[model samples]
Each structure stands twice: as C-alpha cells, then as structure tokens.
Target: MHVLFLAPEVWPFKRVGGLAEVAYDLPRALAALGHKVGVVTPKPRLSQEMEQGLERLDTVLEVPVSWKRHLAEVYRHQEPSGVEVYLIGHEHLFDREGLYGNAYGDYEDNAERFIFYSRACLELARTMDWRVDVFHANDWTTGLVPVYLRTLYAGDPCLKDAASLMTVHNLGNQGQFWHYDMPLTGLGWEYFVPEALEFYGQINFLKGGLVFADMISTVSHTYAQEILTPELGRGMEGVLMARRDRLAAVVNGIDYQVWNPADDYRLAANYDRHDPSPKARCRQELMGHYGLEDGGGRPLVAVVGRLEDRKGLDLITAGMERFFEVGLNLVVMGYGEDHYHVALGELAARHPGRLGLTIGFDIDLAHRIMAGVDMLLVPSRYEPCGIHQMQALRYGVVPVVRDTGGLADTVVDQRPGVEGTGFKFEPFTMEAMLQTLDRAKQAYDRPQEWRGLMQRAMAQDFSWQAVAPRYEEIYRKALELAGQRQRA
Candidate 1:
C-alpha cells in the first residue's frame, strides 16, 4: 500500500509540538512494515541545514495559491530502514524563522497557507501517478486534503478511489475562519452547513475533515472518547457523534532510536534496563546543573513544557508552598504566560537552592532533565497527546500526569497491588495533582518499589514498533469504507 502524509511541519526541519513527532515516527514505522510511504510539508527555513544526506529529487510542479503561483521542489531522504521522506519547499509560506508564528501570534494567513499545501499535495500525487491507497492527514493544517479527495477528486479516476485518515491533534485548533473563505478552498457554500465545515456559523477545516474523511482519529483512545462530549469537543461534538462509527483511537508512539536511554547522547551517563549505575551519574549532573543538593534524602521533581493555564500549571503554582514545606526540590522549564514566568522566578528567589527554573525551550536540557529527575510532572487540563511523558518514562523517570488523554492510556497508576508504570491524578484540580505528587514523594521513600516502578516504565515499550500495525489496520479500514461508498 502507498500512503501520503500531509502536514504543515515535519521533524528535525520543523517541530512545533507532538504532531511533528508523530509525523516523523509513524510514516517510517509504516514504511518499515513494507508500505510505500511519502510525506508533504511546508519546507521550513532551517530545511537546508537539516537536509544533510537527503537528495533534491526535482522541481515537482507549479502549485497555485490565491496570492501567487508557488514553485514547489520535492526532496527525498531514505532512512537506514528504507523509509522515504519527500519535502515540499515553497518560499512564500515557509521561509520564516519559526514553524509556528513568532511570540506575538499565529501566522495571519494560516488558513490560506495550508489550503495551498493541501492542493499541491493532491497535484503531486496525480502528476507522479502514484496509486495512493491512503492519504493520512494531520492536525487542522492539512484538514482540507481529505475534503479535496472526497469532493474535487470524487469523480476523477486518478483520485476517486484513494482513501483517507485524518488525525486531530487538538480539538481547539479547528482552523475556524469566516464562512466566505469556503470558495477559496474550491468547495462551495454548500459545504458550509451544520454537517460539513460549519461550526456555529463559521467555517472549520478540522470539522470538514471529520465529516468528509473515510475515518477520523485523535491522539489517544481516551482522547477519542473525550472529544465526543460537550465539555471537550470544542463545539464539534454533534458532527463527531454523527460519524462515531468511523472514529477510532490509536495512541501515538516515540522514535526509540532517539529516545532510548542506552544510546542517548544527551545524558551525562547512558544506561539501559539492565545496568542502573549510569542513571545515578545523570541524576547528579541534573542536580548540579540546577544547583540542587545531590542527595538521596529529598527527591527532585522536574516540570517541563509551556507554563500556561491549559497545562494546569496553575496547580503547580498554587502548590509551591506545600513543596517547600514538604522539603521537596522542584525544577521547572519551558516558557509561557508572563505572569506565571514572573511568579516562578519569585518562587525560586524565595526558596534559594531548593527550586530551579528555566524560562524557555532548550532541547538538550530537556533530555538531561528527564534523565536526571526522579519524577516528571504533567498536569494538563486536556492533553490530546504528550511526548515528554513518554520520554521521561523511557529514561526511567516516573511521570506524575493528569489522568486524561494519552496520560490515562499510557500511565498505569502505581498504587498498592496495582503494579503500574507511573502516578496518575484525577479531577484536574490543584488538590488532585498535589495528592498524586505526594504519592510519588511517598514512593521515593521505598527504594525497591521505586526501582520496580522505574524498571516497569523502562520495560514498557512505547515505540512505534507496536503502533504501526494498528495504523495499517486503520488504512485498510479506510480503503474498505471508500469501496463501500463507491458501491453505494
């Protein structure tokens, strides 16, 4: 089977969040399973630097946009396992410093930019004459790709039979815009109804994909169920409910080659499941880096990623007093919300060596922190899927995550007789998160139980090896659904 993955950003060249991580890992996993897989994404400004060992295939074609005719170049890279990647380079949409917009806001023309990319993807597949069995679309950026397959190319022999699977990374980012832009997508006002692109009288790209695509997926099984509710759907539960039969849940996986503890160059000492000596060295390095006391008395807990309301960071912020009172050392990283940033800095200043804080994105520090810390904190209000927790688990660091989305699906609660992987909290409140943290702190007292939990988390395989076959099944299901539609 041949599959085309459509996204706004790809890994290494452009990474905004977990979507890029999934885009990077899943296709290669599928290719390893003996499927012909290809990807089309807006070439990032850093693409040239990241294109080492990749060959420029050729100038594909002139792709049309509402603004201008963009010349798209196709580049290919074969992984060690024989998976292929094709990058679509267009200067106008992608020649920017960042994958997402700058600190101010999102790109003003994101809708138009992604619409152009989706159209170019279809054109490339048609010109190459590839019998694309499945077109796997990610997030809201490439949402219109499925719409094009089902509407514009519905009757064309070259495209009519191609199936599609659309994954919604987050429900909030629905690419909502004015209804007038429907014509620009080559679809008419007819699609701007309650059942199609419409969401409360506005146009929604993700909604269109959910309504028109052969099958729909969210990041995790729990998330698949979450989005069908009024509280979590972000105003699209009605449409999702109508198409629940075609909806399924397959959790995301990590690239083990990069995330494996034994081979990771980011750590001070590399250790695997067998030998745990290197982990102590890494922990010491982490403590030294953060100015925390390198001792076994107090466990060091690390919190990473954006400091926003949605991350439920307020829970942590509100519970700082308890941490200091309980003699727990905390390390905080990543950036968001000016007020939260200021408050955290003040907490560190007041607590002296007990608290460590870094205010922005640093890839190297992230890996080191994960490896060094005894526990990771991820208290999200509603996480579709989080990659950092998986990274922490791989490093033998138990994660204390809110029991929602992928966290619920992956983390097994380490209570008495449970034999779980990590600590899980419910209610999405400060008290609940604090209770879970207290449990993690309690587990730190018993070294054998802590080691057993760490070993369990490390032993559990979250790699794409176990997940790709499920995706293959999804593709086959999409093809079957498309065939049924044709017969009907």
Candidate 2:
C-alpha cells in the first residue's frame, strides 16, 4: 500500500504536541511493514541543524487560496527508516517563530494559512507520478484535505480512487471561524450547511473533514465513544453520530527507540525492569537537583504536562495542601495559563523542600522524572491518549491517573493479582484523587506488592509494532468505503 500522511507538525522537525510524535512514528512503522509511506508537513523556520541534508525538488507548486494564488517550494528527504518526507515551504505563512503561534496566541490568519496548505497537499498528490492509496490527515489543521478531495477535486482522476482518513487528536479544538472566511477555502457555499462545514452559524473545519472523509478515527477507543455524546463531543455529536459506522478508535502507540529505559540517551542511568538499581540512583539525583532532601522517607510523585485546566491541574492545586499531609513529596514540570504559573510558584515557595517545580519543558528532565519518580499523576478532565503515562509505564513508574479516556483503557487499577499495573480514581474530583493517592501510598508501603506492580507495568507493551496492524485494517476498510462512495 502507498500512503501519504498530512499533518501540520512532524517530530524532530516541528513538534508542539503528541500529533507530531504520531505523525513521525506511525508512518515509519507502516513503512517498516513494506508500505510506501510519505509525510507532508509545513516547513517552519528551519535552523541549520534541522535541514542538514534534503533533496530540494525544483517543482514550485502554485496553490490557489480563494481569489489569490501562492507559490510553495517542495523539498524531499528520506528518514533513516525509509519513509520519505516532503516539506512545503511558504516563508510568509509557515516560517514563523513558532509552529502555530508564539506565546501570545494563535495567528489570526490561521484559517487561511491551513486552507492554503491543504490545497497544496492535494495539488502535490495530483501531480506526483505515483498513485496514493490513502491520504491520512491529522487534527483540525489538515481538516480541509478530505473536504477538497470530496468536493472541488471530486472529478479529478488522480484522487477519485484515493481514500481519506481524518484522525481527531482533540475534539475540543474544532477549527471554527466566521462564516465569512468560507471564501478562503476556495470551496463552494453549498458546503457551509449544517450537514457539512457549518457549526452553530460558523464555519467548522473539523466538521467538514468528519463529514467528507471515507473514515474518521479518534486517538483512543474510549475517546471515540466519549465524543459521540453531548458532554464530550464539543458540539459535533450529531454529525459524528451520523457517521458512527465510519468511526474507529485505535489507541496511539509510542516509539520504543526513544522511550526505552534500557537504552535511553536522556536518562542519567539506563535501567529496565530486570535491573532497577539505576532507577533509585536516578531518584536520588533528581531529589538533589530539586533541592529536596534525598532521604525524605516519602514517595516522590511527579506531574509532567501542560499545567492547564483541561489537564486537571486545578484539581491538584485544590488538593495540594492535603496531599502533603499524607507524607508525599511533589515535583512538577510544565508551563501553561498565567494563573497556574502564579499559583504553582506560590505553592512551591510555601512547601520549600517538600515541593519542587520547573516552569518550562526540559526533555532530559522529563525522561529523568519518568525514570526516577515512584508515581506519575495525570488527572485530566479528558485525555484522548496520553503519551506521558505510557512512557511512565515503560520506565516502571506507576501511574495514578483519573479513569477516563486512554487512561481508563491503559491503566489497570491495582488489583490483588499480578495483572495490576497502576491506580485509578473516578468522579474526577479532589476528594476522589486524594483518596486514590492514599491507596497508592498504602500500596507503596508494601514494597513487595509495589515492585510487582512496577514489573507488570514495565512488561506491558504500548509500542507502535503492536498497533500498526490495527491501523492497516482501518486503512483497508477506508478504501472499501471510498470505492463505494466513488461508485455512488
């Protein structure tokens, strides 16, 4: 099979979140299975380091955006895993200080920027010598791909047999804009009705993709079902319900090459479940680095993600004082929301030796935290598929997470047998979280039991090799759907 992946960001080149990581790993995994995979993403302001060696194609694509046309330079590079990467360069639109926007906010012309990129992707496919079997798009940024394929380019021979799959990483961020911006899409007004792009009197890019794509998938099976309801759907329940048969829920996978503790370059001491003496050394080093007492006689719990309301950081803030009373030390690393920054700063100051805080991302530190911490906390309001917990499990760090979405699917609450890997809580409240922490502490007190749980976690596999077949099955299903639609 020949597959083309369209995403706004790809790992090691331009990454802001998990989508980039998936965009990088999934295609490589497929390519390893003998599928010819290609990735297309915007070329951000590249440093000399990011563009070391790449074949630049002389072909300049003239992409139309509404009434105007923009030129883009295409460059090709091959990954070590044999996947080809195509970068679209439009300095005026993509070569920015950040991927989407800077610290202030998202770029005001985001709708237009992505619309242009989507059209370019289609044009690139239309002109390429090889035929594409699947055009897999990710998130709201590439939402217009399916729309263009089914609408304006419906009759184009090149794309008539190609299928599209749109994977929604987060339904919360539906690309919604004023109805006036519909012209920017270079698509007809007929697409702006409620059944298509329109969402509560506005133009919704994600809705357009979901409506037109041969198939739709969320990051996790639990999240796929969650989004079909009003509370979690973010106002797309009706449209999604209409395409229920076309929806899929494949859990995301992690690249073991980068995350494996036995050979990780980032960890202070590399160790796996078989040899965990290095993990204790890492814990001691981390405690000293944070200025906390190395021998506190308490479990060290860590939080590593954006400190936003959606992450349920507020729940931690609400229960911090009580958590300390239960004899546990805390370490946090992330940056988000001015209020959270200020609140976390004050809390860290008050607790001094008991709490440690790092305001920004440190990749090395994140790996060390996963290797060192006794427990990892992720009390998200709703998580599509969290990579942190998966990485934590890989490092033998027990995760105490809210039982929702992927967390619910992956983490098995501590049970009597050897099957248990982590702890979970319900209702998503401070009280429930604190009680869950108490349970973790109880298990922690029993060193024999905790070690068994850690062993179980490290033994569990969340690698892409385990998940690539599921995606392959979905791709075949999508092709069948597209063939039917084409015949109709």
Best-performing candidate as measured by lDDT: 2
Model 2 off-target regions past 4 Å?
Answer: 416-418
Report the C-alpha lDDT of model 1 over 1-488, residue by residue, as the tens digit.
Answer: 99998888777667766777788888889988998888878777763457675688755767766546667887776767666677777788778876657767878777777888888898888878878899999888888888889888788777889999988999978888777776668777788888788888788888888888999987899999999999999888888899999898888899889888798898899998777658989988988888886444688898998899888889899999997666678999988788899999999998878898999878889888988888999999999888888888898999999999998988999888899989998898878888888888889889989988889889988899999999989899999999998899
Query: Each candidate's lDDT (Cα)?
Result: 0.85, 0.89
> Candidate 1 clashing pairs?
none
- Model 1 stretches with alpha carbons more than 4 Å out: 51-54, 66-69
Tens digit per residue, CA lDDT, model 2, 1-488: 99999999887788777788899999999998999999999888888867777678988988999999999999888899999999999999998988777879989899999998899999888768658899999888899899988888888888878999999999998888999999999988888898889988999989989999999999888998999999999998888999999999989989898899899887778888887768887888888889886445799999998899999999999899998998899999998788899999999999888889999888889888888899999999999998899999999999999988999889999966546899999788999899899999999899898888888899989999999999999899999999998788
Q: How does residue 269 of candidate 2 score in lDDT?
A: 88
Question: TM-scores of the models, in the given order?
Answer: 0.95, 0.97
